[model samples]
Each structure stands twice: as structure tokens, then as C-alpha cells.
Target: MNLKKLLVLVLVMHSDAGIAQNLDTPSIKETSGYTLANLSIDSQITMFYYTDITPAVHFYGDILGLEKTLDWSWVVFFQTGSSSFIGLVTEGHDAFHDVQPSNAVMLSLVTNDLDLWYERLRQWNEVTFLKSISDSGPIRSFMVEDPGGYTVEFFQWLTPTE
Candidate 1:
């Protein structure tokens, strides 16, 4: 009846009870009687509506260096990452008809080379610089506006201090 033996016995008993409970309980698909076969969520796509998609395509694909994945005339999808995409939809064509650029939402792009990005973006005359590259806080970042007026923040995370 040592303390360590008692603790081990208690843990084993608890684990057994948990396993028994899990075996008895029905899964969501069984209890709800609804299979998730209809819904297969994988990637994420942020859609921005614009009156004309040319400028958006130029800014996202050409300037930002995002690869153009799909083009549907009304909507053009740019691959941001392996599973993330930014879609520019022609206004009045898709689900959004009366939508306008609010410039409220800020899309952040994390990078390892902040200085290189800053230098490149600074040279682009079409980019509206919102903030200069500053490493004052936890994140070293610079904000700029896209052709569709979306605030794009390029940032690099600073190493945590001991």
C-alpha cells in the first residue's frame, strides 16, 4: 500500500472507467443520425469584392507574388499557402452585389525576411504605405494598402525574451 502504488491503481481505475464510458456513448453521426459526408471542409479562402478585378489581380498575383490558382472570370483565386487562398470576386456578379471596400479588415502575412519585404514594398509606387517598418514591439511589421483598399500587414514575430 505505498503512495506510488495507490496513485497508479487510481489512475488505472480512472482510465478504465473513462474507456467504458466512451464505449457506451454513441458518436455524433450515430446519435444525431447525420453523416458529415455532405460537408468536407478543407481550405480557407478570403473573398474580396471589387468593381473591377484587374487591379486586384495585379496587386495580389503580380505584386505580392501569390500564385494564381484559378480564374473563373468573375472570381479569381490566388493561392496564399498550401491550403489558404485569397479570392477576388467581381462585384455585382457573385453573392455580393452592393458590397464596398471598407478597409477595416487587416490581412496579416507572416514572413521570416521582414527587411527584404519592406525594401521591395517601399519601391512599389502603387502600394499605399500605412506604417513604416518598425521592430518596436512583439512583431516587426509594416502596413500597406492593396489595390482593393484592404490593409495588408507584413510582419515577423520577434523571438521571446528569457
Candidate 2:
């Protein structure tokens, strides 16, 4: 190697952190170095199975103003973000996941216009507030109950995100 190249290599080798760990080891698990064979996710959709899908559809499409990607009798999809979607599904015997009395899922929407949303939601009689507008550490948020009894949260980051 040239003299300049050799000197630079020696300096990096003797850094304060000492020798770095070898990264050539084959990865086979779920942690760092894990590998997937050209797997790319296009988008994600979180679905809520409801006993009655009409009001749920109106809540997302009309109240929330999420543009519908697809609409049908059984299901409706709304684009919440560039790569995220929320779907409302009709509950029936033929449905993939049968509707239960209670659901554990909470749809959290991150937005910058938190106050504007809160004001808009307040004016609508259709929206029922589960939690009033409040602050929670790194975020300010509020929760609302949808027509299907799903908890939807709107939050805004208070501090800079990494």
C-alpha cells in the first residue's frame, strides 16, 4: 500500500474505541444483522371489525376526512398516512375476525395540528370524547370513542423527535 494509505489505516486501527467487532458474521435471528430476502412492505392497514359498519365508515371518512382508498358494503379503507391505512369491516359469520364485544386496539394518529383537530372534533355531535385534551410528557393528546367503540387518540409531539 502507499505510505499515505498505510498511515491513515494505522490511525483508524488505534482509535479510542479500539478494535471494532467483526460484522461479517451471518445473521439468522431477529436482532441486529438479521436479514430478509428482498422483502419490502408497501403499506400497512389496521382493521376494526364492527357490528355495524355504516357509522364507523362515516366517522373515518367524513369526520376524520381520510380519503377512501376503497369502499364496499363489507369493508372500507382510508389512507391515514403515506404508508398507513385504517379499515372498517363488517362483522358477520363469514368475516375473517369475528366481532367481539370489546376491542383492545387503540388507533393513535400523530399530527402537528392538534389544537385545530380538537376544536373541530368538539363542534361535532357525532364525536364523543373519552379523554379531554391533555398533555403527556413528550406529547399532547386526547382520546375519542368512535361509532364502533374504538378508542382513537390524536397526539402532537411537544419536543423535537430524534
Candidate 3:
């Protein structure tokens, strides 16, 4: 079987076990005929460029309460969720050079406690509140701007009867 097939088989077996598997250390028998290269595309990390990372750190870490996983001076990584990370690259860095910040993309976060987040963020004078708490369709949401001028939306999904 090809590498992809082998990986699928292993994943299927683990899934059938009905237990959470540690992605850092996948259990695979050598007899399965799969190598490390076959599972190279393990996880993905999303990144955003910034002219300065200090504000990014303050916004994501201090304000949003995301854990700072890595700090590489020019590049910093924040743990956004399980197996998900957001990287901040400083301007003049190869990855951020010539790139302009745009409102075309917004980082959205879904939460069960929208009111709590709103209360907390409102207390911070640095937070730029674009929209107040409002219910629209099936979601209750609000918008804020980070120091980098990026729009961040916080929302909670409303139940059918709500």
C-alpha cells in the first residue's frame, strides 16, 4: 500500500479505538510499512505579519489570554486552540516584507461566553470596540480592533430556541 493508504489505515484503527491519540507521538507498528515522511503534513499553523509584535503579543496574550508557545524574536507563536497556532512575524522579516495590513481578513473566535469576553475587553482602554454586542441571525457577536488594526470578531452561536 502507498504511504497515504497506510496512514489512513493507521488513523482508522486509532479512530476505531475511540480514544484520543497523541499527535506528537503516533503509535504505528513498523510492520505497517509506513515511514515518518508519509505523515509529514501533520498540522498547520496560521500566521499574520505585523510591523511590531509587541502589540500583537499584548492583544493575543494579555487581552485574549492565549498562551505564548514560542518567542523567536522576529517571529512569535500563540496557541489559539488545540493544535492550532497563530504566528506573528515582525516587519522587515522576509515573511512580512512589503506586506500591508488589510481588513480583508478577520480573525474570528467562537465562544460560549460572549458576555464575559465583552465585559473583560471593554475594561481595557486599548481595545477598540467596533461593534457592541448584537444578535443577528444565529449568532451574537461584537468586533474589536487589535493594535495592528486587524479586526477580531468574538461570537457565540445561539441555539434554535434562543
Best by lDDT: 2
Predicted candidate 1 versus true structure: per-residue lDDT over 81-131, tens digit per residue: 789888888878654654574755567677898899888877788889988
The parts of candidate 3 lying over 4 Å away from their true place are 1-44
Looking at model 3, the pairs that clash are none
Prediction 2 TM-score vs. true: 0.76
* Candidate 2 stretches greater than 4 Å from native: 1-38, 160-162
Question: Root-mean-square deviation of each candidate, in angstroms?
Answer: 12.8, 13.8, 9.5
In model 1, the runs with Cα more than 4 Å from the true position are: 1-41
Q: What is the C-alpha lDDT of each candidate?
A: 0.76, 0.81, 0.75
TM-scores for all predictions: 0.72, 0.76, 0.69
lDDT of 2 by residue, 82-144 (tens): 999998999884679988788777887889999999998998997999999988656688989
C-alpha-based local distance difference test score of model 3:
0.75
Model 2: per-residue Cα lDDT at residue 135:
81
Q: Which should have the higher TM-score, number 2 or number 3?
A: 2
